[model samples]
Target: MRWSNWADTSSVCGIEVAEPAATAEVSALLREASEHGRRVRPIGAGHSFSAVARPVDLAVDLRRLCGVRVIADGGGRVRVGAGIVLGDLNAALAAHGLALPNLGDIDRQRLAGALATGTHGTGGRLHGLASAVTGLTLVTPDGQIHATAPGDGLFEAARISLGALGVVTEVELATVPAFRLRAEEGPEPLDAVLADVDAFVASADHAEFFWFPHTRVASTRRNHRVDDGGGRPLPRWQSHLSDHLLGNRAYELVNRVGAARPGWVPALNRLSAATLGRRTYTDASAQVFCSERSVRFAESEYALPRAAVVPALRDLRAWFDRTRAAVTFPLEVRFLAADDVWLSGAQGRATAYVACHQHVRGGFADVFAAFETIMAAYDGRPHWGKLHTVDAARLAELHPHFEDFLAVRERCDPARVLTNPHLERILGP
Candidate 1:
């Protein structure tokens, strides 16, 4: 069989694949593969952009092991199968008047895929999805099932192991009561926007900005929590027009044009940023946080110290001028609270996430490499699921608990059942 991830950046051929419906079935499959000296890679929905899911021997598909299993702690939390897609998981949570603490803009990822990749949403005081996990059940390569909680020695590593430790079978998430967000979005000058970064981060429950690479304007968002019980969602017609039509289709068409000339990118970006304009609405937190994203692109994102964002972005702008690279996609900037997860990008301090994107047809090497170089000065950590060239030696220097994570991985899967070339490159052989 052949497999490819969502962005089509990574692919693999001639792999054995298995989809086990129950935990016991997974254990048996792992043990069988282990005896044959066949390594196993567990993949969920193929949403990651990186090669973390590229299989070396057997691709253990987990789509069948999905959906909510139990609601506990008086329904404030949910224990769900790892393979449940985020869109479905959100709906399931809504039915119980509960929701995950945060969500990234894209919701097509499976629950396990999101957590393992350290997927995060935007908020100064909020951490990534893995941080919301209070407990988890992992099936080691040796076919042993072990459970972990927040204080457990292995808990930190299990949350965002990047599929290096074991396969996550189930997750116990601490959810918040369903809430609503009042989002005010509009364009602002880049200078004015960056100058008030601290005030902006402190004022909103969630905030983000998108600056078209060649333009001076930025689309700013301030989403504040509102108590008016889950106010009205966007009208279906308006939502369809703005989200599906303009957000995805129109954006795709513009990128197609940008691909051909590349020289016309700056003008096109200004037009898009100017025309996107302003809008305000109140909706369920999930609805407000996530938007449909169908236009495929390769991306590189780095998490930097909160104070370093402005300087890094400034350097990026200078690089663009120096290289005159014409990029059409907006540079997205977001914030997150510190997390204790061993491999989390935001570990140990408040962080700002800056992401750069390029249409599939356009050249991205120079820009991606440039930003990677710029972000490095701030001790940046790459998002595990995104594009990055950092290796284990460099990574070990960035993460505080680097050795501890390796120690855990060594003990859990000493036979190296859950590793591939990519893990070897990034986490060492």
Candidate 2:
């Protein structure tokens, strides 16, 4: 069967798909694949837009190794199988009165995929989702399952290694007590939003903004943590209309229209901006953090120094105007605290994430390349799971612990059993 990622941007064909139910089985498969000179790639939910998870010789679909393995004390630590869906894991954790502290809006990714690609949510003090990982069980090139934790160089390297290190079979996450969130969303002028971005980022527990290109307006979302279910959530029908109908279906239709008439992008963005009004509700933290994202798009995101965020946005806007790019998708801006993980985008520095998207109908080469140049100017690091052309040379320059991560990769997989062409491009041959 042909294997393709969710956005259909990355695909690999004529490859063997393996479903090993147990860790030992995974080890055995690894040994077998290696002996036969076959490359093994573990495929998760296929949510990544990049070829980070694309299989060359064998695609080990780990969904078979699903579910929570252990829920450690009320201290809120849970060990989960790598292939468990983030949504399902949230549901399970909710049952135990525990929850992940932060999560990206799209929860369709499997745990392994989410952590591998450095998937994240928006918050000034919060780091990417993978920062929650306290330990992980990694299957080495030699078919040995090794569990790693902090302090050891292996733990840091394995956390966000982009699947170039090994197969992540189990992840131990440090969770938080189940909490509630009060979500407030409204439209604000893009210029006004950027003017006091630092204050805006600091005031809310989580803050993010989306600015449709060629439009003066930005839709801002701020979610605050609460002691209790802060207030009533939206009624079922209201939610259906707001989330399913307007967010996905209507948005998709707008993109379709924009794709057909490139010149109409400015008008469509204005109308889209006008349609977004104020919305407020309170729900479980997980419910408020994750959103329905059925509309497919190809994206490229980069992590910049927190201080460079407003400047970068200003430059991007200038580029959009100068080139008169026919872009209909809004630019997404978010923030994260610095972390110690070896390859995390926000590593060792406060970060602001900027992501641009293009509807899947056509390739985003021109704009994506422009954006890449813009990001490169700000010393930004590309998100692993997103689209980019940066290779090992520039990457080594961007990441301080680059050589350290390479040392660990060599130690863990000396034969390069866990690599593919794309990884070879980013991590070196």
Candidate 3:
């Protein structure tokens, strides 16, 4: 019933806002919008940096329609309301001795939203979150609900539609028996360790690293399968100190100082990376996958060939050395194998994902631009949920199934009822 004239996403990009409660309401809303010749956009938690969720006319917020339900245990799949956040769902899954096969860095966004944009985490042998989706229930432009699954022509396309095709109501996710992960965190020499990033990625069940920008220091994380030993959880106070204080608070101070005086960033980076110390813990799969990122920063991430990471990062370092712009936040590097999703960044390519972030109020343009330039040379595919400036023409070159996805979108949304201006620009009409 209410709309924001102008809104900004988590990354501070301008957007429009609309609220819708359920699939039926969103269906009727889209139909009415089609009659009036207006565009409709469905938004989740506004976690994306790209304008994909921005609408010029109608914006549909699915926040109120979130819940987790078990549709079929025998089939090893469950139906989750599209708007359910990953954090909430994981808790529910824990109760049922079930968990998602994989997860991204954070769990703040809606399940449908994360899959729609091909959001992913790090694992050489694992696929992305979208790949876990065995089927989905989508509300079409004419207010018809369709259940899609593998082998269905519309299945692959709907798996990662970027909210351009229709409003997704519920998704059937393939799950695994709940498992525990032993997580280890420590500081590593940036140059020495990166010499074999590929091998390291392949060896670890889950591997991700954070390199301090403007410095040769990085934090390495490796998680592997572990027996369910009865290890007690970290005390709330200790967890808060380690995650919130040391990880976010100290990080914020480091950025504030570096932003004010660029020259101080390098030493700060070195110290910050070292300050992570060494940590070891065991937790549920989702708990291990999620990390608290309270420090506000804007990020741009691209997935390139696994072999391209070192050279691309070297090129980025060179750019940083030459440019006057200063970046304080760390750069995160992750890995993922190729996936079947049409719009997935790692589609058909064993990829190394490089993410560059800058302090929210700092000058991120130069560093982000430099990264973009380096990635462009390596046939990089930008994450649709992250910050980028690629349109349909550029995107088509990166994705092999681009045209196929478009055709499916056309069939599902002939009138483009769920499309926003940003979706149109990237996927075209």
Better of 1 and 3 by lDDT: 1
The count of backbone overlaps in candidate 1 is 0
- Give the alpha carbon lDDT tens digit for every residue of 94-168 in model 2: 998888999998789999988988899989999888889999999887888888988888888889878878788
lDDT string for model 3 (217-317, tens) is 66889988776675545677977898899889988888889878888877887788778778888888888899888788788899998889999988888
> Mind giving the per-residue lDDT tens digits that candidate 1 earns over 84-130?
99999999989888888788997889888888889999999998999
The C-alpha TM-scores of every prediction are 0.98, 0.98, 0.93
Candidate 3 ranges with C-alpha deviation above 4 Å: 1-21, 230-232
lDDT of 1: 0.88
lDDT score at residue 365, model 2, on the 0-100 scale: 92
Give the clashing pairs for model 1.
Answer: none
- Sorting all predicted structures by TM-score, with the top scorer first, yields 2, 1, 3
Alpha carbon deviation, residue 373, candidate 1 (Å)? 0.6
The positional error of residue 427 in candidate 2, measured at the CA in angstroms, is 0.4
Overall local distance difference test of candidate 2? 0.89
Candidate 3, run of 10 with poorest lDDT:
3-12
Window of ten residues with lowest summed lDDT in model 2: 66-75
For residue 408, model 3's alpha carbon misses the true position, in angstroms, by: 1.8
In Å, residue 388's CA in model 2 sits off its true spot by: 0.3
Model 2 scores a TM of 0.98
